[model samples]
Target: MGHWSRGEIERAFRDYSHAVVEIGRSSDWSRYADLFTEDAVYLEHVYGEMHGRERIREWITATMSVFPGSEMPFYRRSGTPSTTTEAGSSGRFSTA
Candidate 1:
C-alpha cells in the first residue's frame, strides 16, 4: 500500500461522505461502488470481509435494502460533521 498525505485521506473521507449521501438520497449506489479499486477489500465487523469492488457493492446493496430512504441519516444535518459514530448513535439500527 502507498502512503497518503493527511489531506488526501481527509479528502477521501469527504468524497466518501458525499457518495454515501448521494446513494441514500438517490438509491443509485453504483457510483459509490465505483470509488473503490477493483482489488479493494471491504471488511465489516458484522458482515465479515468481502474482496473486490463487486463483492462490496453486492454486500452493501443487500444490507442497505433492509432500510428504506432516510430512515438512517447518511448526510450531514445542519452543517454538522457527518461521521459514522454519529450515525451509529442515532438509534436507527434495530436489534431485530
Candidate 2:
C-alpha cells in the first residue's frame, strides 16, 4: 500500500489533535464521543486502556469536570477529513 503525502497526513494529524484537546477543554463529552469509531479502542502503552465511544465520552467528561476553570480549550473550527481509522494511535490521534 502506498503512503499518504506528508502535507496531507500532517495537516490531518494537527487538526485531529486540536479537536480532541479542545473537546476536553470544553468538557463537551458528546462532541468528543462523536469523533470516535463505533467500536474504538484507545490503548496507552504507558498507563492503561479505553475502549468504545461511550467509554471515551465518560472518561473525558469525568476528567474535564474535575479540571474545570484551569485552562480553556478551543476547537480549531475545523477537523480532519475522516476516512475512517483509529483516532488515538500512540503519538498520533485521528480518524478519517
Candidate 3:
C-alpha cells in the first residue's frame, strides 16, 4: 500500500461525499459505481461480496430499487476532512 498525503485524503473524501450526495439527490445509485476502481471489491454482510465496479453498480441499483424516489439526506458530523490526517470512511443516511 502507498502512503497518502493529507491533501490527497481530504480531496478523496470531498469527492466521495459529493458523489454520494449526487446519488441520493438524483436517486440514481448507479452513479456510485464511478467512485470505485474498475477492479474494486465490495463486501456487504447482507448482499455478500461483489467484484468490479459494474457489478457493484448493478447490485446497488437493484437493491435500492425497493425504495424509489428516496432522498438521502447527508450530514457531516464531527471532524472535517481538512483536519483529518489519517484515512477514514464516510457514511450516508437514508430513510426509505
Candidate 4:
C-alpha cells in the first residue's frame, strides 16, 4: 500500500462525513452510491450485507423510506490509515 500522511487520512474522513450528511439530508440515494467504489460492500450487522454500489443505494433508499426523518450522526477522529484495513473505518455512529 502507498504511504498516506495523517492529514490526508483525516481530510478523507472529513470529506466522507460531509458527503454522508449531505446525502442523508437531501435524500439523494444516488449520491450515496457515488461515494463508494462500484464493487463496494456495505454491511449492517443486523441487516446483513449488500454488495455493489447499486445494491447499497437501493438499501439506503428503502431504509430511508421505512424510517422517515431519520438522520445519521457524524463524527471525526484522528488516526492513521494503516491502523485498519478498511478505509474510513475509524468509527461510525448512526441514528434512525
Candidate 5:
C-alpha cells in the first residue's frame, strides 16, 4: 500500500469530484477527455463497455448532442469521489 494519509485521500476524492463536475460544465470536449485514463473502460448497462479515450469522446459528443443541454453531475456517497470496486474494476466509480 502507499503511504497516503487520510487527509491526502480526502483531498484526492474532493479534487476528483470537482474535476468531474468541471468536465460536465466544459464546452470543449477535448478538455473533458483529459479527465479519463487513456485506456479507461467505460462500463454501461445498455451499450456495455467502451475502452479508450477516443471511444469515450465520441460517445460523449454523440450523447451531449442528443441531450442538447445539461450537466451530468457525478456525486459520491457524501459528495466526495467514491469508487465502485465491486462493480467491475478496482477503481471503478459509480455516478450516484
Candidate 6:
C-alpha cells in the first residue's frame, strides 16, 4: 500500500463524514451499503458481527426502522485527537 500523509487521511475522513450525513438525511439505506466494500465486515458491540455489505445494510435498515429518527454522530472525546498512531513502522494513525 502507498504511504498516506496526514492531510490525505484527514481529507478521506472528511469525505466519509459527508457521505454519512447525506445518507442519514436522505434515509437511503442503499447508499449506506455503497460506503462499504463487498466483503466488508461489520461488528456491532451489542448486535454481534455481520459479514458482507448486504448483511450490514439489512441490519442497519432493520435497526433504523425500529428506532426511527435516531442519529449516529461521530464526535471525538475532549482532549483526545480523532486519530491515534499505531505501533510499529506503519506510520499510520487509527481513527478513534
Q: Number of clashing residue pairs in every model?
A: 0, 4, 0, 0, 0, 0
Position 40, candidate 5: lDDT:
90
- Write down the lDDT that model 6 would get: 0.67
Model 3, span 18-93: residue lDDT tens: 6776687677888888889999999988889999999999988888787756554566546755422222243344
RMSD of each: 7.0, 9.3, 6.6, 7.2, 7.9, 9.4
lDDT of 2 by residue, 1-96 (tens): 348987787687777666766654465666877888979997755536898989877876665467545332332234434432443423233333
Q: Which pairs of residues collide in candidate 6?
A: none
**TM-score result, candidate 4:** 0.68
Specify the poorest-scoring 10-residue window by lDDT in model 1. 87-96
TM-score to native of every candidate shown: 0.58, 0.53, 0.69, 0.68, 0.64, 0.69
Off by over 4 Å in 1: 1-9, 70-96
Deviation in angstroms for 31 in model 4? 1.5
Model 5 TM-score is 0.64
Clashing pairs in 4: none
> What is the C-alpha lDDT profile of model 4 across 27-66, one tens digit per residue?
6767877888999988988789999999988887787667
Model 2 segments more than 4 A misplaced: 44-47, 70-96
Off by over 4 Å in 3: 1-3, 71-96
**Residue-level lDDT tens digits of model 5 in 1-96:** 679987799787767766665565564555666778999998867778999988888877776667656445453464344541122333333344
**Higher-lDDT candidate among 2 and 4?**
4
Residue pairs with backbone overlap in model 5: none
In candidate 4, how many Å is residue 59 off? 0.6
lDDT per residue (tens digit) for residues 9-83 in model 6: 777866776676567666665688789999999989999999999999898888776765755444443543345
Instruction: Give Cα distance to truth, residue 32, candidate 5, Å.
Output: 3.0
Which stretches of candidate 6 lie above 4 Å from their native place?
Answer: 77-96
Off by over 4 Å in 5: 1-3, 27-29, 78-96
lDDT of 2 at 53: 88
